[model samples]
Target: MNNRILVTYASRAGSTAGVAEAIGKTLIGKGLQVDVLPMQDVKDLSPYRAVVAGSAIRGQKWLPEAMQFLSDHRSELSRKPFAAFMVCITLSMTNAGQYLEGLKSWMSPVRDLVHPVSEGYFAGALDFSKLPFSLNVLAMRFVVLIGVWKQGDHRDWSAIHAWAESLPSRLLQ
Candidate 1:
């Protein structure tokens, strides 16, 4: 039987969706049958042998849709070889270690709920222009004052690819 993997994500302004696509491409490159879909579009997880669920963190929490996806599929997910990933601006290059720690804490609840075989923390993009007006203004000001926020996509594509390529080996064992 062919091994199929579902790659699903929850994105607010498309950055996380880009991450999901990159992951899907990497998995496909490894000869795995993969489906990349949005969390809202995926109603069931029964068709795939493994799953990789990703979310964009907002205010230190998993996006509502993603959290619900996990809660809704907890039982099915528990039976498979699964992985979880989160994308966030907090993971920008300069503060990667700190951001990873925060991501770990934020994911703890869902991690316990799903008990995945592997998990990942990916750096995400921050386009102030795409953010809500109030948030954009605040983020801009914070960047100016703190001197840490650099505009442009900050995702580490290589790291994402490496993680995706390793999943099949991890799950099939």
Candidate 2:
């Protein structure tokens, strides 16, 4: 059997999951066998030749399960072609470059642990209805008060697709 490419992700409010799916579809279009699964569902890495992992950012960190997945498979990951991505509403804010700089600081725990051949930073969606009951109140009120955040989908599909298009060659080579 051909070694498949694994695309695993952790999502909250669903934006990151959509991004992961898009990555999986793009890879499939490139004629590579792929499997996209939630990070928690993946138990082994031996069947895959490459990996792409991502998570939604909350309080500036990858979700616990996503981080744990990487830590658990660090050895296997180090030997394979790997890539990572992140979804964050902060990326839609002004001064995105600075936001990314701060995001890097937040992602230190993961970076210090494993290195990916490439990394993607994409804007995320924000739907007040999807946020937890408590956060919904806070986020809605915060948006109304600060006028800094708007509720809508902000993912850049062109960028996401472009990034994914670059992966097969890099990984398969």
Q: For this target, which candidate reaches the highest lDDT against the unseen true structure?
A: 2
lDDT of 2: 0.87
The sequence of per-residue lDDT tens digits that candidate 2 reaches over residues 38-111 is 98899988999899999998767888888989999999899998898989888887777776776777667878
User: What are the lDDT scores of the predictions, listed in order?
Assistant: 0.86, 0.87
Q: What lDDT tens digits, residue by residue, belong to model 1 across residues 1-173?
A: 35899999999889999999999999999888999999999987878999999999877788988998999999999998899999977688674785576568888878878987888888888776787778745956687468776767889999999999889998766
- TM-score for each predicted model, relative to the true structure: 0.90, 0.90
Worst 10 contiguous positions by lDDT, candidate 2: 136-145
Clashes of each: 0, 0
RMSD of each: 2.1, 2.0
RMSD of 2: 2.0
